[model samples]
Target: MACLGFNPAKIRNQNLHYSKPSSKIVPSSKPIKIKPSPSQFSFKLHCLKSNSVSEAPLSPTEPQISEQEEEVDDPASELSFLDPEIDPESITEWELDFCSRPILDIRGKKVWELVVCDSTLSLQYTKFFPNNVINSITLNNAIASISDDLGVPLPEKIRYFRSQMQTIITKASKELGIKPIPSKRERYETVYQRHPGFQKGAKPFLTLDNPFPMDLPDNLFGEKWAFVQLPFSAVQEEVATLKRTFTFGASFDVELLGIEIDDKTLIPGLAVATSRAKPLAAWMNGLEVCSIEADTARGCLYLSVGISTRYIYATYKKTPTTTGEAEAWEAAKKACGGLHFLAIQEDLDSDDCVGFWLLLDLPPPPV
Candidate 1:
């Protein structure tokens, strides 16, 4: 690490600071402690569901309740049956995006819009408001309008990605009795083209030009690191192996992203071994890790996380050997549709991995 030739002080100063709401703050000055789980972190894909098996069949000696009788026995069931509005089962969660768009109204002022879509991407509700009227009261009204529509149900949870809009969005969601989650998923783009700005063939207004990669905190750096990979056939087996032992880090179903990999496909990865595995893994658990990219020109590795934030993971002296690996890693990542992994361990020989993240380089959201 000493010979990596990177200065933490310079990296920190070079970082691009993003603004968040002042009313609420997430304390990131110290490592976040997360309760360890057996499998791993997940993006909570909707395509997967857990099946619960009945523990035991009903005994013949026990009283049998007829389906009709059971409905009559429960008073709450009567009220639910009587009401035809708001089928909660229709939508479990909604992805929301509230931001300024490139389009301007007739008055020539910036237009602000609220977009809401269900997890299945089948239903959407969009409402536009002038800049002056953007607030929790207005947002709450817009959501209520959607819920009041015939057969449209209010979602149990609402997820929004932009941290800058957290305060107002959280307020609106709470007022509507929906749990608000800050997530980094880009599912909101499904309805982007429907926006009026893009309807007339307007050019895309935004592109992700991430800033220079900044070095991670000195203490968090691993003692040693290496580029590694596993055949697609062995990934599930490896995950099952890690589950029986100690493990931490993020993971998601590749099928959730609509990606299909052949058994022979190689999944590129980075493995880091360090004595500070506990804190390093804990810190990574707090991030919405997107992907890792190799910069062979500068002989650096960059990690993209939490919206548009970028960090310098490692740096090495440029050479034919290192350059070849870097290019190969890049090619493999592209072949896998940006699917990759990061593993942290106590040491190279240790059987237990402290951290492992299944990262995806999702395409940028629609401008």
Candidate 2:
């Protein structure tokens, strides 16, 4: 019998033939190039595929697998798009071109007429005037009528009135070339009197009392004076310039002793003492009595070292003395009586030296 079984080589060749033929056959239909609409594409690709593909059988026409995915990505497609409500160009036009309406020019008009014509603007205009005149608006029937029509609060309207009066006062003062005097709180406090006295039978050296008597002396000779020296840094050149020129103009003669640094000293005093003196001088306009006679050789460059000192000295010199030098000397002795005395020494340590001594006479009673 002829062998019914096929040859092993032929069978193997036949299996290979079947596989090659299956892969090689060209598909009859061209790929249906149906582009998906955005909504339809999104629904199937995202929602439906995610939900039904896991369990339900896919349609025969649908692609079973994704084609070769792109390796390179487009960066522009990743960015989100935004829409703004306002047009930038329109905004520019509005700012540059728009003028809503015209406002009235009511300069030099009566307050009532101004209030009546434009109640809304009346309060603002009144603020430019003084309170006294503004207060008078209540008596004006036209102003009252406007206030009633506008339903403005009575208190607010009164405030406008007060503001008007204040404006008037300010204007008058400006016109008259008179500076308005500041209220008491704004004014610097004056040194009315300074008296030093020991408690009855107390040791004078242990306790130094400031003997500023309220009673005006008949003569202001040999009165105690204080000198405050100001030391400024080189960085404060502007302040220093102001201090030198405008500070001591004809309005008031200020004695400028000289400038010093933080390290420099007026006399044999602590660096802190000289520093303290600067602020004191600034506050007092450098007023003080001459402690020692002006000596060009001993670092005492000026007669006295402060603007305040200069003013006090000048004032004292201009005022008349009731008692002569002899009586003044006696009074000085009386003032210094019982206090321990130390000789004035320039080279002495700051601790060893006594406090500064000034011969300032009390001013006579005001007539």
Q: How large an RMSD does model 2 have?
A: 46.6
Q: Per-residue lDDT for 26 in model 2?
A: 16
Off by over 4 Å in 2: 1-127, 130-223, 232-315, 318-367
Positional deviation of 10 in candidate 2, in angstroms? 99
Please write out the lDDT profile of model 2 over residues 210-290, one tens digit for every residue: 222132222211212222221112113323444455431111111111112231211111111221332333433322332
What would the TM-scores of all predictions be? Answer: 0.59, 0.14
Pairs in steric clash, model 1: 214-312
lDDT scores of the candidates, listed in order: 0.59, 0.20
**lDDT of model 1, residue 240:** 63
Give per-model CA RMSD.
16.7, 46.6
State which candidate has the highest TM-score: 1
